[model samples]
Target: MNLLDHIASVAALAGRPWHDHAALAADEHLRFEWYRDAVPRDEIAFLRLVLADPDREMAISAVLARIDERARSSIDFHSWADRVEPVCAPVEFLSRRLAEWRLLIDAFAGRPVEDAAVLAASDWAQRKLAAVVDGDLLVLLAEHGRTRRVRALTRVPRPARPVRLSDRAVTSGPIRPCYG
Candidate 1:
């Protein structure tokens, strides 16, 4: 099944109607409580639900808030990883990461900018671009000529060091399995 289908299935399992925006909004309090207390698997599932829906910004903000809370409480990486893995698998994480990178690039693409006033402006832009496109999937896109337009706008020079693909990029296949 595709990601949408997986989302629907997970929402169904959670007794939520994935497509009913008004219903979701009306039940925001309950959703918030669920997010607050959910285990890692459920939390990731809920996050994917929000990310897939149009009300993504609010949902993502809530998730980030919870993450911040957990971090401040001294939740360590091992604990977080134990909760997040297998459900929020590396491939799934990588796909979302790449999507966010593309979104950021697209958001900046249309804005007009003056010529760099100093070397720092160019350097900052290059650094930001490098961070967004750091992983192998993005580098593969660059290699396949998909990034030429973005590179033109960002003027991000390729990294001087060899790019090591993240373990997250080594997926068994697409984030969503194709049933047919």
Candidate 2:
């Protein structure tokens, strides 16, 4: 589907009304090209609104992907970066970092983790990445990730253990975590 159609569909999913494309566009450059290209200005406001709702992030991300594909092909990205300073740096850095990390992930796939090495590497990477992507954001993400892992681990049933009496051993119930 074309960009506006995709935008409309996402907006519809969010129960948002169609908005004018002109208002939602990034700048006059994009707007002028949109007009020059005979792009319709009606019914595409969800681009702005959906950004405010976390639930629509995936859909918006898809739309942004399409927009990115189009923008890279049609617009002067460096010019846009000049207007929106620091725009390209994070994306460029993260893209490079993600590529680097993907190789590590692939190498580690299906392999047993070496805990001490993995922990040390993770600590170093987290510290480095925090410098690039804000320290507090990394902390919040790490905390969330740890919480999820802990919760998942807590839910798994442990094998039953034996309780010993004076002369007999009896199997006890599955051990579960006691969470405060």
Candidate 3:
């Protein structure tokens, strides 16, 4: 289905609640230890569960592949792809990498982990891992660039401050009226 469903499935398999998995983000000051604690096992096992579910597995795989391609080409990943990388593809790839991993998980109704499939997924995931992990920085840079460019292109001059007139100037009456 959607991301939340995928994460919940994985979390359930990990013996953790959906809420804990739902809240993780790189930008969050969360530690990797927190993730390790939540999953409480090798990363791959978590992935097999997601892939085992037919609902969003292919979609997640496609997203991961796309992200990997982007990375190989040195393109920046967007926020959505970044999310998929850690929770979806990376774990899924690991699951597939271990030969018996498929059997173990699938026996529990987990998806069968194919070596080729997982390896391919892993290759792409690893290749793009840097980009996925650093996607926030790229987003920040892009936002910063837009801000700077907008400021430069449409800058308005600041209003000049006015000088206060001396009290004498205000007090001095026009010498005036020569009896005119």
Candidate 4:
């Protein structure tokens, strides 16, 4: 499965509507099981190295180093890096770092990255999944029954468009204001 699919599956297994801490913790173990069963052993080992590193920058640098090494050796670096990136960040900050690294890789390779909207949406989803996996967000959600609204509030707003008035001849002396 692709990275997004794997993320969705884990999120679904964690909870519906919202995640609870207990459920998230359980899902974390289940996620490992799924990764073991589905992903190749070598990839899993690489993932472990990435996730085990406490320093987010170091973890990202390590992944980039591997990508460079693989590229030099004529290996399928992009395919492998794609899978490893999501797993490297089990936390929100690290996930942003991962996204930044991804963009940097794309720029360095002269490959066009996805549009800003698409990238933002993907990053948001990844952050939510990471928060669920980390369990802290889930715990907070569980503690406050109505906290689901907080999630809605936290969502990134779309950019507002500038309003433009049409230049048209008016038959009346005064223009009537219309409210939607």
Candidate 1, residue 137: Cα displacement in angstroms equals 35
lDDT of 1 by residue, 64-133 (tens): 5555455445425335544544443434533343333333343245422222211122333333543445
Model 1, global lDDT: 0.45
Return the candidate ranking by TM-score, descending: 1, 4, 3, 2
In model 2, what is the error at residue 158, expressed in angstroms?
Answer: 55
**Over the full model, what C-alpha lDDT does candidate 4 score relative to the true structure?**
0.44
User: Cα miss at 21, model 4 (Å)?
Assistant: 36
Candidate 3 lDDT by residue in tens digits, 1-180: 655575566666666673554564221223223333443354345544534544344534533443344333432333324334455544655324332222222322333333333233333232222122223322332333234443232232434567666533665566566675
lDDT of 4 by residue, 98-158 (tens): 4554544454455654444223434333344323322333333234324354344334353
For TM-score, the strongest prediction is 1
Candidate 4 has its poorest 10 consecutive residues by lDDT at: 129-138
Candidate 3 lDDT (Cα, 0 to 1): 0.39
- Indicate which candidate wins on lDDT: 1
Candidate 4 lDDT for residue 34: 38
User: Where's the lowest-lDDT run of ten residues in candidate 2?
Assistant: 34-43
RMSD of each: 20.1, 15.2, 19.9, 19.3
Alpha-carbon deviation at 39 in model 1, angstroms: 3.7
Give the C-alpha miss distance for residue 70 in model 2, angstroms: 2.7
Better of 1 and 4 by lDDT: 1
Ranking by lDDT: 1, 4, 3, 2
How much is 149 displaced in model 3, in angstroms? 42
Alpha-carbon deviation at 41 in model 4, angstroms = 6.2
